[model samples]
Each structure stands twice: as structure tokens, then as C-alpha cells.
Target: MGKFAKWLGAGVGFTLGGPIGAILGYTLGSFVDGFSIQDFTQEQEEYKQQTQQRTRVHATSGDFEISLLILASVVIKADGKVDRRELDYVRMHFVKMYGKDRANHAFKLFSGIIKRQISTRQVCMQIRQHMTHSSRLQLIHFLFGIAKADGNVSSSEEQEIHKIASYFYINDYDYTSIKAMFYNESDSAYKILEITKNVTDDEVKKAYRKMAKKYHPDRVQSVGEEHLVGAKEKFQKIQSAYEKIKDERGMS
Candidate 1:
């Protein structure tokens, strides 16, 4: 198989169908001919095992990159036009994840995707089917990072992100928690901890611990160094949120 074919078939030990498959088919068409659907049945069982092992070694490999690229294009175009800042932001992340050469190639693919209209719901649902909760959460975090690349997350960008999160089955609390990290509005501390003002001191501490573990960078080490960096950013927000709550409540 070719590079794009191999990468596109990396997730779930099989090729993805639906909108993701369609997007890959269209975007990768020029570089490779016929870009047909993958067949897993002909492969030896050992190859399947090796593929699964590779997935374990690199949690963000293969279709995950494709998914990120396509959905990222959607987020970049959410504001009606793509901003250079947003493109740079995504390019940096792609470079970190795949290095300079693959990032350049992927960015070219993204140029195609950015021109097309995508169904956020369809894409999110497809991702939710194959990705774990942590992976989906990281994907949302990346999207928010792109949206705020210009130093502000517009209402349109936020709305598009919210729609993606809803389709991914990410609860409002989790969604807002991630949102607070990028957009520092009032009640940000509360949002980061995924709690309300009505919560007691014990609840605040509990929420802090829960969020701390949830966003710890180590949790995503298997995914890649790029994801670890993003996770650390989220983990720091959780720590800051807890500290703010502790200072205000005098919880020694």
C-alpha cells in the first residue's frame, strides 16, 4: 500500500468508511491513483496482530492524523475564512506530530479539505465510533487551540466546537472545562474544575483531583509527544483552577 493508504488504514485495524473515507478519497486522489477502499480479509492474522501492536505503540498514528486534519480544517474555516494564524497553529501541531516532511504533505491535503464543506456531525460521529474518550477529548483540545490561534475564539468558532463536542457525546461540563482553558472568561476557574459556585469545599477538592488525573500529560504518552504537550497545558489549567478555588475558599 502507498503512504496515504497505509496511514488511512491504521485506525481500528481497518479502513474507515462514511465521511472520513469520503474525505480521504477526495483529498488523497491526486497523489495516488484509484485510492480504493482497503481490504483486511486478505491479510494474514499475524499482520492484524502487528497492526494492533503498532496502534498500541502509537496511539495517534494513521487515521487519527487524517481525522485531525479534516476536522481541523473544519475548525479553521468555522469563522467563514481561514486565518493565516490558524493555519500556522495547525501546521505547528502537525509538524510536532509528524515532523516537517509529513506535515508539509498533510498541509497540502488540508488545503483541499478547507475548500470543501464538511458535516461536523458526521465527522464527529465517525470519530467517536473509533476513538477512545481520551483521544476525542484531545481532539477537541486541539480544535480549541486552533480556534484561539489568533488570540480570540470567536462566537462562531465556539459554536462549531460545541456542535462537534455534542456529537462526540462529550457532556457540557467536559466541553466547558476544555473551553475555559483556551478562552479565559469569568468563572473560568469553576469551568476548569467542571463545577458550579454552589459546590462545597469537599466537592471542589474532589473535582480538582478528578480533573487532575483526567488531564495529566502522562495519560497520553502512548499517543505521542505532541499530545503530551497538549495534555500538560490542560493539566496546568486544572492545577490553576484548584489553586484559585483554594485561595478563595481558604481550604487549608
Candidate 2:
């Protein structure tokens, strides 16, 4: 290993890990990158060492970074087309949360992840499996912040955000409250669902069918699948949510 490879490895690891792991990995990478390489062989050996160490750290962060990217991509693409306002919102949040340098790097990483089609459920499952409840909640909050950054929320964006939050097992109340901060007057998808908390069998079927069609992956295909990973999750969530409502109401 070379110095660059070492730094790259550390970045990959940091992006994959939890908060503490990410901090530690970033610190180590910063320190290592400050040193000058003496020769090609030494550099290669150093790079290899760094790569191994970094990968170990990354085992935790990669999923985190990927998850964020997936959500960001979905949020940006939620309303018909992605706009500069949304991109700026993302950049601002990144810089504010991670600082300028780290934010720049994170933006690049996030953009790369969103630029392609990936599996939203897989990413959410990875987060659910690996992250603590608190961490997951915090992530959900961050996402809510992202959605609200553009002044108001779109129906598509709200549905996607709700779906993401629910995957982390956030309840109807917290999800809606967070969502409420982004929108005024109207109830969120989560809240609307809650209204039917005691819905009849027919209503449950009707709602599910409506939501499935609205959030259907097919609805977003024109924008390309890269943008619909989150939509797919929302689509599935429509089913999951409907099931919960139906089961609670004793509806088949």
C-alpha cells in the first residue's frame, strides 16, 4: 500500500461503519495521509496494509453511506424531476453535519450511490440488522430534515420518507410528527394510515390497492429504476402497512 490506497480504504470503511467507527477510521486516515511515501515497493506494501486495516473499519460504514445515498437519491427524484434546490439542500445538510471537507467527500460518495439503481430493501435491512434503535431513529430524523430542507414536502417525497422510517420500525406517531414538521395542515401518509388504524376490511383493501398503485414501482420506472429503490420499499411498505392495519382491525 500506497498512501492514497490507504486513505481510500479508510474512507470506504468509515462510510460503512457506525458513528464511532467512522470517526476513528477518519482520524486514522487523516493521520496516515499526512506521511510521504518513500519508494514504490514500500508504498505498495504500505497500501496493502492500509487496505486491510481500512476494510475492517469499512465493514461497518459502507452500509451507512450506501443507505444515506439510496435515500438521498430517492428524495431528490421523488417529485417528477430532481432540481438544483434539492441538490443544494443535500449539500448544505452534508456540510453542516459533516463539515466542508468531509461533506464534499460524502456528497461525492452519496451521489455515486444514488446515480445507479440499487436495492432499497436490502439497504434498509442492512441498517435494521446492524444499527442500534437510536442510530436508526437519528437516521430517520436526518432524512426528515432532508425532505423538509426544500420548504415543503411533495406527496411522493413524503411517502418515500415514511416508508424509510417505518423500515427502521418507527411507529406511526413519531413518523407523522417528524413528517408534520415538513408539512403544514395536511396529515402525512403515516397519519392518514393511522386514521384507518381501526379501518374495516374493505377500507384496508381499498387503501392498500390505492397506495400500491400510487407508489407502484412501475409508476417510477420512467425515471429509471435507480431512483425507485426507495419507491419499491415504499411500495412494499404500502403492503406491510396495510397488513398491519388490517390485522389489527381483524380484517383478512
Candidate 3:
């Protein structure tokens, strides 16, 4: 069987339901032989408890993988065309997740999606409906990294990302915090910590502690190793933000 077909067949053994199922059904219906929602749901329910505890849910799961590719494709085309840098960045992540061969296949799929007009708002709404808040935050963070891969985030890309964050129901504070990681801004350090200069030293420390826990690489166990690696960048940003605050305050 072809790579896409193999991926779909393997996914059939998993609990692939809800919006994710709908999207995948539409995207891969032609390639996936004998695809049945009823059968998949029944099997999924049978193995629900066993899989629930061990399922890595996002990025690793078949549905999540497709969702990531769809969103990533949209982000890649946001600036009007795909840049080699952006493509390489995404390819590297996929390679790490699914090996070179599968990554190539997935990239082909992504490239095909990029060629078409994607209803990004609709996709984000579906993702938000099925994914957890943390998972959605990670998705936005991944998109930001891709935008910065070409050394600068275009105005159009930034606008699209902001729209995505809004659709994900990410609050202004969290959105700005994630943006500060990729974009250079005057109050980036404060924003990364999700705080303001008006806050006291103790509050700064508290914010740092909270952000540190939130963005820690260990928090992304549901995804693959590459994602944990990606989380490290966010974690580092939080650490750097705290250090900057400490230095400015002359606190040892």
C-alpha cells in the first residue's frame, strides 16, 4: 500500500473520531480503502480505556498529525508563497517525528494542501473543539517558530497567526507572551513572563515560576520527542525572561 494508505490503515486501529475524523475522512477518503466511521468508532470504544492512558493524543496521534500538517500548510502559505527556509524547518520537525521516508510523504501532502485555499478559521475552530488548551497553545507556538524560520515574520503571516490564536481562544496575554518569543519587542521580557513592570519583585518571581511550569518541555509528553525539543525553546524564553527581570532589578 502507499504511504498515505498505510498511515490511514494504521490509524483505523486507533480511536480516530470527532472533528479530526471528519477532516481526515474528507482529506484521505479516496486513498483510504473501506473507511468506515461506524466500525472505527466501535473499535475505538472497545479499546478506549486501554488507549486513553497511553495515547500521546497530539502530534503523535494520526488525527493530530494530519491536523498539524493542515495548519502548518496554511501558515506556510500565509505570506503568499512557501519559503525554502519554512519548508526545511517543517521538514526537519516531521523527519524527527516520522523518519525521513514518511516525512517526505507527509511533506508532499502538506505541499498539496498549500497549493489550495484552506479555510484556516474553520480548521482552527475544529482543532479548538477537539484539542486541549495546552495542545492548542503548543500548536500556536509551533506556527510562530515556522514564521520566524525565514528570519522575519511577514505582516500577513503575523496577521494570520493572530487570527489563529483568536480562533483558538487564546487570551491576549498568552498570545502576546508566545509572540514575544519569535518577535523582538521592547517589553519582550515582561511579555514572555506574562507580566508587567508594574508588578513587584515577588510577583515577577511568581510569574516566572508559573510560566516555567507551563512551558516546560516535560509538559508536552503527549507529543513526540521533537516536540519536546521544540518546547525547550519556549522554556528557554521563559528562563531568559526571568533572568532579564532579575538583572534589571539588580536582584541577585
Candidate 3 local lDDT, 51-102, one digit each (tens):
6786444334554567778788888888788799998999998787677987
Clashes of 2: 15
Model 1 clash pairs are none
Segments in model 2 whose C-alpha atoms lie over 4 Å from true places = 1-8, 11-66, 186-252
What's the C-alpha lDDT at position 189 in model 2?
37
Tell me the tens digit of each residue's lDDT in model 2 across 107-195: 65555445555445555655676555544544565576566667777788788877877777877755664454344443343343444
Give the TM-score (vs. native) of candidate 2.
0.52
Using Cα atoms with residue i matched to residue i, what is each candidate's TM-score against the true structure?
Answer: 0.81, 0.52, 0.80
How many backbone clashes does every candidate have? 0, 15, 0
Judging by TM-score, tell me the better candidate of 1 and 3: 1
Q: What is the C-alpha RMSD of each candidate to the true structure, in Å?
A: 4.4, 13.1, 4.5
lDDT of 2 at 225: 36
